[model samples]
Target: MKVNIRKWNGVAIWSWDVPKEEVCGICRASFDTTCSSCKFPGDQCPLVLGVCTHRFHTHCIEKWLEVETSKNLCPMCRQWFQEKTDDGDGGTGAHANTNVHSSDVVSTT
Candidate 1:
């Protein structure tokens, strides 16, 4: 009696629903990490996506919005950066333009 053996090959792919491939526009730092002002990245400085689909670090975007020049506009699209409402869960939820009056807004993650 004789037996034969076969080898199997497989591939796995991973992805995230982020708006960009890398880095926050405002701070120019990788999405996987936090901005300069933050002592740590990750959960402490998670990424935030604007209604315009522009991406930035959470801390970075907050600082940018606080500036008088920003006027609550997305740096990339110049669209009114609608604020996101917390889902009550740990993650962020849909976009709510409670301040502005634009119909082109999209939900953020």
Candidate 2:
């Protein structure tokens, strides 16, 4: 009898409270995984969504927003990315409830 085992270990898995399959529109990277430019996911490279219901890696969107051609619009939907308030209470006005997924509603953290 011969027994062979390559490797065995517990791997952590993470999921986002998104209706569609969790994937960053900008980098197309899974929400549980880091973008190509990032070495790791989570706080280091968190996921952020725009008012248009489009999602992307925080770093990825931040960089994209810096581009002169972006005009503060979402890449997928071209909707204005409503800026959040200073206290993170989201923005005021029409897009205040733009957030599709609420942490209080469905969060693993």
lDDT of 2: 0.74
Question: What is the C-alpha local distance difference test score of candidate 1?
Answer: 0.72
* Candidate 2 off by > 4 Å: 1-13, 83-109
The runs of at least 3 residues in candidate 1 whose Cα sits more than 4 Å from the true structure, single-residue gaps closed, are 1-20, 84-95, 98-109
For each candidate, give its TM-score against the true structure. Answer: 0.59, 0.60
**Residue-wise C-alpha lDDT for candidate 1, range 20-101, written one tens digit per residue:** 4677888887776568877765666677766566778888889999999999889888888865556564434443544454
Predicted structure with the largest lDDT when compared to the true one: 2
Candidate 2 lDDT by residue in tens digits, 1-109: 9989899898987666665566888888788788888897677887775555567888889988999999988888888875443344443335464466565587569
Q: lDDT, candidate 1, residue 54?
A: 73
Q: Which lDDT values do the candidates have, in the order given?
A: 0.72, 0.74
TM for candidate 2 is 0.60
